[model samples]
Target: MNTESLLRDLREELDDGGLRGSFLVRDLHTGQEIGLDADLEFPSASLVKVPLAAATLERIRRGELDGATQLEVEPGRVTTAGPAGLARFRHPARVAIDDLLYLSVAVSDGTAADALFELTPPAEVTRMLREWGIDGVSVRHATAELADTPAERFEPGEVHLAHALAIRAGTAGRGHPVSQLDVSRASAGSARAYVALLEALWRPSEVDAEVAARTRDLMAHNLLRQRLTPDFGSDATKWSSKTGTLLNLRHEVGVAEHADGQVFAVAALTESRVPAAIQPEAEILMARVARTMRDHLRSR
Candidate 1:
């Protein structure tokens, strides 16, 4: 099928699935690309961790911060919303900066991310990205702020109401009643911007090679693999990625390196109109759509 027809079909499919997203896939070698609303911005939930990791490593490389330094982290000191890492610890633990990077990026640990944020504030992370010549991704707040949404107020059985509110409360300008969902108020990025980040990591340019390599390694070790990993990962391919999620938003950005030396950077940032969470079908649809784009680019 031609590009126009394929994009039209993909748009229809996403609408049918009650999803609206910004997706981009770019061939690293040739700079060729394809997308659906790639420039549309979405509140970047945990996705900010990637930049956090990069900035932290950059500081380490510059001898400003030592990765071997250990910090005392108290249990439940940060947000308890996360399902993994230091968020679940029952007691205070002293974790090294390097291990904290692993927990923050690879495990999507909100507490660990906030811990890192303490060392390098959100504004500092944004400054670091600017210094690296990365744009379109804005880091405005820490991970702890992400846990304070309406989703947390609702009873477990009625959490869908929060999702419903998330779906219905957005303005055409992308403002939201919930600060965490508002692009202006929350950390946000476009698919193209994230794909650019992936490109920088996969093919270092403005970002230092060592920092990018370490960031890429953290993504490769990511434990949250149920989203796009199934489609992009295989024996013949290596998929390195980071996932971000909030009330109704789900996103994943990664690089797929084929054994044949072809590398494609993909970013899928999506918001669901569906009220219910835990939509495995939505996750599957996202992966399929992104993989289809990758396959298309590969063919050309």
Candidate 2:
């Protein structure tokens, strides 16, 4: 039941499942933790939604934005990647703030994230992190810069040149590898910052009440299918979360607050050899940790 034994068991489970790198799990209330390759930074997919959502709402609290404000998805704004919510619409989307937040959290909509990213550029997102008193975070590449991704990284300005370099140097504005991802629009984040965001949310003193509430509402609406939710874990525990995958990455992060107030915030992520269609295997590995942690807490 201790962290060392718990970590040893998790490593075995992930290895048996053929997972890559590490996953992180924490005891939010007690400050205890179990990590298998947790600190190793890997690309955070939709997991970035929590921060982006908090940043947008933080702006609203500052009067920099009106909560019900709207943005028109001009031809240039509409994109085919990410979640297909409005894209499923018959015409270009002129989504309101509510709808954008809904689609972003509910479905991990790439387009929705781009919309928010458009309103709050990555550099500005970093600013929000500092203002909120969160640390170990940096976001410099605007989601819109995705447009400059070279058709190939070998050729500068390809799809992900900006992002690729950023990830390598552990900083944003560096560059992203394009050619591989340039074909389609994409974005990235880190696990450490993601949890910091949730920690901030769980204890909203870091930001205004209105901002925390709105962001929580947005996340609440966006429910991800995970091992603990109705969709994946066979009704084990209800989870309001974001699920993400691409190439080799599989991830999910959210607050799992039980009826008893034994809330646990988990960020389970990994790079994997599994194909995109079956990436949930990595999540399943993380879920094993979640189930165990939940058991330990219940025993208390």
Candidate 3:
């Protein structure tokens, strides 16, 4: 495949839509790769949970944590970002660590993700990535911090649209007083770095084989496919990914496997020009880019 021309075409496609972003797609089995702005760091949004899940699973393997361990779902941990899994509960409910991992990664459940942060702090997650030789990635704050970041300096409450519009306009999260949308202030990683981590998750080396297997399984079961799944999802092709959403940003990293034994790891992270508080175009563009990369990789 002519990767250079593919990227040029992709740039045109994105320009037509008035979208800006980064992407990295690798044919894991062949080591062929292609991307545009793959090195640029973007706000992690919910993508940080993928590494958090890997760390937690590895700790369980080392006897540092237990998958079967149960913890209560306190109301303070809940957030409106994800499904009503734990948030719908009327009373404090005890949930297993295993379930928490599923909720955090598969469902992008902020409450469950924040709960796991108490066990494996951001610092520990960072250490795990470095120890595994993953670079160009930074895991800094908890999902709760991401939730409460807006309230830190500017507030009235979570003004999701107002903040999103400001951030999309590149005025909210830039310098001086950091906003939640700031890439530097938030958990962030490049598309290349994420593809590297996905490589590890699929074929284990630093982490235990069993742990990696389980981690991949959980990620494969990610319930929300609206980001990457809609493009490559089919009976012959399997698309599994973790999605990250905050204001105008929509990101997802996952592996797509064809029935013929060819596998590709792709990370598409995009920030839209659409100013709407709820921009479906951003989400659609993410899938469109993934499909473009997938088609290019498969053609080879």
Candidate 4:
């Protein structure tokens, strides 16, 4: 694959659409790679949950955390949006830690993520990744604190659309016209950094093998596959990944293993100039770009 030429083409295409993004694709087994703005940092949205879950599972493996521990539902922990699990709870309830982990990653449940974050703070997760040699990745806060703006914060009483709109209105500190914070202060990582982490998850050397496998298992069940799944061609392509979404940013990073055992780690992180919270075109562009990259790598 002519990675250099491909990236140049991608840059021009994205620029034509007023979209800016970062990409890093590496053949895990061969180590051949390609990237575009791969070193630039972007918000880690729900993608941060991957490492958060990984760190939590590692602690459980080391006996620092007990998966069987039960946690009580508090008012602040319930997120305004997301799937069943913590967000759907109507009353005070106790949930097992293992279930919380599943909800956090599998379903991108914000409430469940906050619960895990309480057990494994962002700093600990960041340190764990760095220790494993995954550099340029920084997890600074829980999903709850990533908002950096009052309107963007998960207020249990507030409507989800309003919360999202506030973020789109740029109520926070500094950002492009679309959102207050296009990038997250809570968690930030470059595409290359995420590719490194995905490589470790695919073939564990620095991290615990069992824990890494468990993390990959959880990510493989990721409910949000609309972004990059279509490009992988068929169900035969195994994509174990994590996705991140904010007001204007959309990202997915994971390893795609073909039927022949060929493996590639792909990170597609993008920011749209459109101000609307819902931009279906951005999502489509992501899938198209990923498909183009995947085909380039596979044909090689």
Best by lDDT: 1
* Model 2 TM-score, 2 decimals: 0.76
- Estimate, for each residue in 193-256, the C-alpha lDDT of model 3 and write its tens digit: 8999999988757877888889889988999877778787789988878888766668899998
Q: Kindly list the per-residue Cα lDDT of model 1 for residues 115-233, writing each as its tens digit.
A: 99999999999998888778999999999888788988877888899999999999999999899998999999999999988888889588999999999999999999999999999
Q: Give the winner by lDDT: 2 or 3.
A: 3
Compared to the true structure, candidate 1 yields what TM-score?
0.98
Model 3 C-alpha RMSD to native: 3.0
Best by TM-score: 1
Superposed model 1: Cα runs more than 4 Å off: 77-82
Better of 3 and 4 by lDDT: 3
Q: Which clashing pairs does model 3 show?
A: none
lDDT of 3 at 223: 91
Quantify all predictions' global Cα lDDT against the true fold.
Answer: 0.93, 0.60, 0.79, 0.77
Q: Order the candidates by lDDT, highest first — what do you get?
A: 1, 3, 4, 2
- Over the stretch 1-300, how does candidate 4's per-residue lDDT look in tens digits? 477788888888887765788888899988888778888777777888888888999999999989999999663443434344566667777888988889889888777898888888788899999888888778887775544444344445553454355335543433434322444544778899889888888885798998899999999898887888777636678988888876567899888888988999999988776545566777888777877886787778
Candidate 2 residue 52 C-alpha distance from true site, Å: 1.4
lDDT score of residue 212 within candidate 1 = 93
The C-alpha TM-scores of every prediction are 0.98, 0.76, 0.89, 0.86
